[model samples]
Target: GTRGPLAGIRNLGATCYINSLVQSLFMTPEFRAHILQWRFEPQQRHAMNLAYQLQMLFKRMAHPSRGFVDAKAFVDSFGMGTAAYRQQHDVQELNRQLLDVVQTFIDKAGTEQVLKRLYEGQFYDYKRCKRCGSVTATPSPYQDLSVAIQEISNLPQALKAFTTPDEIDGVSCDTCNDKTTVEKGLTYRTFPQVLTIQLRRIDYNRTTFERERVRQDVHLPLDVDVSELIEKSVVGSPNASDDQDENRFELQTVIAHSGTAYFGHYYAFTRVKRVERDAAVEAKRLEEGEDATEATVGGEWIKFNDERVTVATPEEVEEYIDPASWKRRHVVHATKKKAAEKTKRDAEKKKEADNNDSNNVNDGGDAPKDATEPVTDVATTTTEGAANATPSGNAGMGTPVATDEAFAFGADLFDNTGAGGGGDSDAVAEKSVSGSSYYAIYRRVDLPLPSATIDTASLDVPEYVLEATKTEDDELSRDAAELASLRSVVSVGLVYRGKKHWVSCKPETTLHELTSTARQVFGIEDTLHLRLRAFSATMSVLGATYPADFTMADTGATPGSSFTLLGVEATTDAAIAKDVWPTQSITEWDRLMPIRVYQPEKETFAYLRDLV
Candidate 1:
């Protein structure tokens, strides 16, 4: 978790599901600003008024009075009934209901256009008769789209699956008196400024007759083409943009759920778009001799987990979605291993070329400007740990590898630059999020952000809120002071066998102390000797071997940094055993690390032996 700048929401009992939804919406700048700009009438001001409570919650979250704000007031005012308030509620269901309530409140205020302008989308579910050649269209309005997760590896695939046409057999057509097969599917009539998608990960199992959560990994693109998913051939379809830029939608928020259908915890990772302050703020910065262009803040993502909000990387968000996907972990290791081997080969080739050039120069001949072999740009994969990459092959022969250090945690393991080498590095840098995304928010690039019609300064500020702000300011000052005085203790990870474990140590803690702690934690006997090596999961390659005399200060080890332990084997049978698959009851199967097996649809159960 990060100690970065963003306020959090405190969960009141089993209210984390609510907290996740609240935080995600608050981080959407345009929406937050719109809510804060609401002008409530004197008669509408009441303790049970949802809109007023929401405005207050957004006000406090934007200008946090403390590290976290109490959301109990908003919860009490939500009017979700007593039973719903007392327990954890489904996020998707609550999300739609909350929007409906907000729309209702704004409708009375005559500003309901804000909700429609930001979220409302029109779609048509159509059926075409084959015999009579007649088409029927049913127009519907939706604020969000719920897509299925079955048989899809990514979001685009899921969208296509949702919109793809299927045959409806033995159906009576309105135009045709006899039954005939009909083509049935949905097409977009209009797209919204902001699009929300819910990945339907929970499906009913036919064998067990129960609903179960699907743990399949579904990749979520940072930018998606909404136009491509729409059926353009339909007569009244929204005009498809010839310019691809206008069709793009960038991701803003991801609400991830962890645990089972009965019990689960919800958290959100939201993107903070760059903000441009007014001229007055810019003038103030200029007067202080600060860079005028430094008026903008944000353009980063943050994780909101109940009372603890921290700065988050895209990789961290991806990993949090499907932390136990073995394929993702394996791809990371395999890609790193390939990159390391390439580096070594490139180094050896460079040395040989240098020696050959020296020999040619000694013989009074000019050295070649470029190598005879063709050159290619190779991408690197990284993880939570830090990594670096140098250009491979001959010098001055090809484009230097533009590394995206952010491509970590099961993203495209290697950022393939593709053929032309001119692809935008920034675009490649933010990899697609993978896993079961319960909720996703995307904003259209062509649409302008919402602007406030009323002046924010005229709003009456609460006295208690002012006092809380003062207290928060004092806390910030104390935190800054504590940060200046560096603490002695720090935590780092130790990867032993196939698992990683974290241990605490001081900056001055020697390699000897680290090894001793590792031994104690891993329950290794004193007789057995352990070897310590500096390893990076980011590179999936080993670093310089450390001597017992080396200290953490010497190595510059910090929090979230990890090392690998070598020269050790499993001490017991339990350590070597793997979790077996449950054949009888599917519910009893391990959800995170399920046993590998052949495709049930394509092969028999006997094929499992071959896979094992």
Candidate 2:
């Protein structure tokens, strides 16, 4: 095959559904090599081994003419035969079966446990007695996790709900020897090189006796921190420091379903990156460098949509999981807006051109020969419109459209400055990096230094600025005041659906009050519970949890320091975020929201169909 990256595979009937997944695995260089190199000694009659078949299938897909072939033998190997093969099969089911065959057949690290080493994470299952305070910890390993997407959630929220402690209904403590209440929770102990999570999208409605699909969006952050969920983490306590490794994961890929559950198609977006040693340092350089000495080179993002492969530009990647961004209505709205703007521009240009012609005729043979004179278009433009309007003179002079400012994503979505710096910013330009020799030891805290504060309000204007920028400075000052208010109050930073938001409140504020503010922000219908999340190593913060009565002061975090607020459902254990036991419900709330749980192994999407 010609090198660089392999071409998209052609579909072979319904077999192409699995081909989408196969293509996803093909892109993963490490896993691809691991599977390809694994030897399966047993030969099953005239048919090829599953590994060999997958190897051959990928090999064929790599070619141009023979892009893909029907996997008649591969499907037959499942043993369900034509009956199951002819009918539609769940993608999750196929994924589980495929992985099971490989994992079971290929025991490369017989004693070491190859599959677990690569995909599994061990958890300490804790059961604590209420009477004696005695705790029992059981080490259980889980290869994959299926997170229930309660309301609208992101990756971290789903994970927190999964790893958060659950209540053991009825269990007797061994030490106490009494059938009293016991609190159960899962503490993350060990993780893998590659972590795979399935967002449970299929929900069964008992009333209708039908499976419903949840199309709510979940945003994936650039970095995912699983440290606070780990049992050894001290973030929820008073002594949680900033030194612990959070086991942060940089999101490399996202496989998304774009349509309804029954008729939906699957596509994937992938960013080429690896977890760097230092997150802070890595955050500084989000793009690859040109230096050959660089250990890793990346930054390109590609969209794999079945046989249609294309570059997913930066803006497309930024709104990867935004539900609104993907809707056809959004596209229509943008199209109409552009059409209106063009219509207006065309009318104005016609008027301007007519005026220019009239002026030439009025002063016949007296007009200047130089065509570089200021045009009537600029003279007629409003202050606000002039700031955004393209220089009509450039078009008149026959300048190329490639260098046009009208095409940038302050208006032109494609005008991307790499993750590191800006296209026109002085800081990104050629400059020396030197700290002042005038370092000061302040006895007391001081205001922010001018050099340290970013002048984000400045526009690179060429003397012909619309306004004096005094209004912008005033706006920045107002924003600074607002930020100060956010810090001084309860100063809670709510992390939900993979986004962080800060809001101001009081220490005496009730859980309902905090959640009420959060609900308004997220526009969610479910009752939200505010739990104390670990202080991010990236930010100094407070720890706050529940008794439903405990105040923010109960966590012992200082005022004015930001607190981490994690949004959870009131139906789930409200105190799970703080690793505490929740009080019992008076009535059966399970009927309120009937949860259908299904798990078939790691890398498999959990569907209610698998259960029923």
Candidate 3:
């Protein structure tokens, strides 16, 4: 048995092969379905997949054909029936060849279109010279129309039809000879302002498509500067951070993407306002004896020697010289010395007249009986008194009596004393009253009052302590009795809240002032209640419970009966008739809403809420 198995292995070379029939039987419908399901869907994707598969299949089938097997062989190896395999292979080959031709046409057309768009809307035609191969550009269709037409007529009708007029001029380079011409035709197509490119992808029965659009604003015609637009829109995004390197990179990318050359749809049409040259007229002007510089050619006038020329009218002069230049030369004529002298003389004369007027008026509307005589005997007496008033041992006498009188009548004159003495009795009285009040309080408390004196030694309290104490007393007065007294005088309630909020019915008092005070003290959102009323004898007496200094007694006397609140209708008819105080109108009260108070120290409304 061992010798038999070894002998068969040597002769057959241990061959292992499956029969075609067995392979076909093993290829189930489920395996074929799996292959078909994975097939690429879009035409492009499908073609690519097929190409790859063919390459792989050829590699495995390498031999004399180097694995480049035909489509027929590929189908047969897949176990497809012979007839179906042949038919499918033929169809696929035809489709592959057709696609190759279509791709070539598409590539050619795309290149041509791009070139045409680049040269669109150009006014000039460009060509190379045949003689020297030098490039030239020209505006008109024919460089020399007369010569080109003559040459065209010499040609046969059939040849002439094929020829086009030459437009470019020859460049006068040293290497070029001006004898030959190159014949070429220029054709162009303009590009649209906005270009949209659509990209499509399809795979495994799924498709995705995206469209990208690029737009350009042609701000100016041909050869115009677009640097600003490029710097702004192309260089950076409007929202990009200035401090980031990425922002700079993004800006550069955008600029590079948008900086492509574009030939617009329409040609720029421009007409230069050229100043014509008139050689003959200018030559004639030069020949004239009158200054050549003053001569004019055509409508333009010339100037010479800085001399003024007589013109028929101001308009003629203006036409010859710039209007702005004429105005600068003619207007605002004045010399500094003349202006200063005039001002000085006028001031001097005014001073003299004022002195004369003063002397006449002081002389009782009459000229002085003796010019240089003393104006009054009182002046002499005053001078004598001042001279005698000086102390005996003083180095100099007191100010001259006449000078003193002059000083009194002039700017620096004032009495710094009280009555006949240079001391303030009222100030002393005020200080004494304050001291006596404080002393009386201290005596009652059995704490000795500090001594009252003008010198610093007499004061025992520190300056800051004294200031703080005074401030505290002032604040206390303001918060309580003073504030209540002021409110009564104004006839306005300062309470903040409820109906009749921030309404002032008091005479000569406005709703604005009451609400303003509430906002200042409470907050913008705080509610306030204010009421105005005609004073009644009883309420007026009760108001007097505050202080006379804070009452509005000047407004009017209070009646002995009940007072009525103006602008506020009573809630009910019975209430209106009754002698009760009226509240504010419901509408006015509804307008106010509470606001969160702004507290600077605590930096929030938390402190305000806690205080409330």
> Clashing residue pairs in candidate 1, if any?
none
Q: Give the Cα error of residue 481 in candidate 2, in Å.
A: 67
lDDT of 3 at 476: 50
- The predicted structure with the larger lDDT, 1 or 2, is 1
Best by lDDT: 1
Q: Which stretches of candidate 3 lie over 4 Å from their true place?
A: 1-120, 123-612
User: What C-alpha lDDT do the candidate models reach, one value each?
Assistant: 0.64, 0.50, 0.27
Could you give candidate 3's per-residue lDDT for residues 281-352 as a string of tens digits?
744533431222212211222110001111122222222222222222222122333456568966997999
lDDT of 1 by residue, 189-285 (tens): 7777788889887888899999898876776765688777777666546453456655688767789888776667888887654444365774454
Which one wins by lDDT: 1 or 3? 1
Model 3 error, position 113 (Å): 3.9
lDDT of model 3 at residue 266?
7
Give lDDT: candidate 1, residue 288. Answer: 44
lDDT of 3 at 466: 38
In the order shown, the candidates' Cα RMSDs to the true structure are: 26.1, 37.0, 41.3
How well does model 3 score by local distance difference test? 0.27
All candidates: TM-score: 0.54, 0.47, 0.13
Q: Model 2: which ten-residue window has the lowest total lDDT? A: 436-445
The true-versus-predicted C-alpha distance at residue 225 of model 2, in Å, is 1.8
